[model samples]
Target: MTLPYGRDDDSAAYHYINAALRGRDAEAWRLLAADSHVEQTDRVLRAMLDRIAVARTHRTAERATARARAAAGEITQAEYQRDAAEDATKASKTAHFETLLREHHRQIAQAARRLRGDDVRDELTDLVLALGAAVDAHRSAVLAAGYEPTPADEALWARLGELDVPDTDEGRTSVEDLVRRHAERQDDLGRVLAGIILDVAGAATSVPRSALLTEWKKTVAPTLAPEQKTEFAAKGKGSLATERLRKTMGHLERKGLVKRSPDGQRLDLLDRAGLADVADGRE
Candidate 1:
């Protein structure tokens, strides 16, 4: 029989399911089941059934008593349904974690097989450490900005924890691919930030770094949080809003967004239209 979840391949179903389970929103669950793939639906249901079977096997006497009560209408159908749903959620988490564990083991084994010597192992270790450091830096920035991670973000971090560098050609190739992907994402973010800087540049030929920080806090910060303020004023290095903006402006300057004055004060905006276009999501 066709399962309800197999109805569509849209990612919305996954989000709906996460929201439904976390928030206990029955309507969201119903909507997700109605629109998602039948196969996906069956997987979850089967998982639930498998869990129940294991429980029954362990508690045969209790199961018998419960069955008798259920048959005699001592347990309402609504109550049974709720219990089953909870069992299914337990199964779902078990399966999710099991998959991640299996994948991690598989990757570790493959990496070891590919790099069969101490020298290879060391090289792989260095590469993996570099990748992990980059990811950690980004995570720190995200946290410093007071942003909360979603479930997907946490899952990604979990997967990254499993990364290993193998000495084989395939392993090196994978590392190279990851590096390229990281660069691309950084470039994209830089472009977006440059656009925002340009929008604030305005009629002034040059903007001071301090002014940029003030304008940014006033403009962009509100869109994210209600009582929006940057935590750039701490004690250490790069610990002020102006310092953060200065670093950002340096990146933009390299990207041709602005030019540094000869006296090393204020930035002269160049290619204003290009920055505005990126800001407006036009090009």
Candidate 2:
């Protein structure tokens, strides 16, 4: 016999059973069962349809719950990984800065050894003090630039005070100007540093080594003491100038004042400190 929508009777029954199993209208099956000539067969079909409906409902609910749990687990895992990465980065930066500080101390000690004509101990102490002042000025610039000062940073500033570099009007003006300039350039410098760090952290990191060195020299040149500035200018001839410039740039690079691009020719400006930070080795 033909059924609704011109389908044969058997096909109509099959469609009704499928609708019930898929969680569609179960009442349609009941209406179909009422009109069937085979009473016993119709009753069996109705029972099977009811069971399928119930099973479908339960299965759908279970699947939904499982999906929610999986999503939450994924979020938690991602957060953990991000935190771990940040911690490792902080540790590495701290280690690098400490190494720079030690080298600075070593340089002062060597200078003291070379100048044996004076009271060597006093001279060494004075040089260390000067270094400390330079570090302090640099720290002030960092803080002014919105960076949190670490304990090591604080110690460096304190050591600068211990070094009896006379706080002349000119010195004060230079240091204050350096702080202001650094603060102004903080955001730009931060972006550059972030880019550098991201590249270094990536699988195929490659940046031009010399670019950082050149930028460091440029950043610090304006802040150096008159004598040091003269010395640097005088040495900037032929190969000697290149070597001195490289050394100066290297010093600034260690202090985080400059960033290098991947190509090595492009030196990106990262920070600004008046002549003081550069002169004091705080750049």
TM-score per candidate, chains pooled: 0.31, 0.21
Q: Name the lDDT value of residue 49 in candidate 2.
A: 37
**What tens digits encode model 2's per-residue C-alpha lDDT throughout 9-64?**
55555554445435534354344333332233233343443444455456557556
Q: How close is candidate 2 to the true structure, as a TM-score?
A: 0.21
Q: Which residue pairs in model 1 clash with each other?
A: 3-38, 5-36, 5-37, 5-38, 6-37, 6-38, 7-37
Off by over 4 Å in 1: 1-192, 218-235, 240-244
In model 2, the clashing pairs are: 129-163, 132-160, 133-160, 178-274, 222-275, 223-275
Candidate 2 at 76: error in angstroms? 74
Which sections of candidate 2 miss by over 4 Å? 1-126, 129-163, 166-204, 210-230, 235-283
Q: In terms of lDDT, which candidate is strongest?
A: 1
Judge candidate 2 against the unseen true structure and give its global Cα lDDT, from 0 to 1. 0.45
Residue-level lDDT of model 1, residues 1-283, one tens digit each, is: 3323434543544444444445755454444334233334333433433444466456556556666777889998777667667766866876665444333323333333334453455566667756665666666677889999878767656555455445334544344445555455445555656655665666766677566667765654444321111111111233343443555566567657688778766678787876676566564
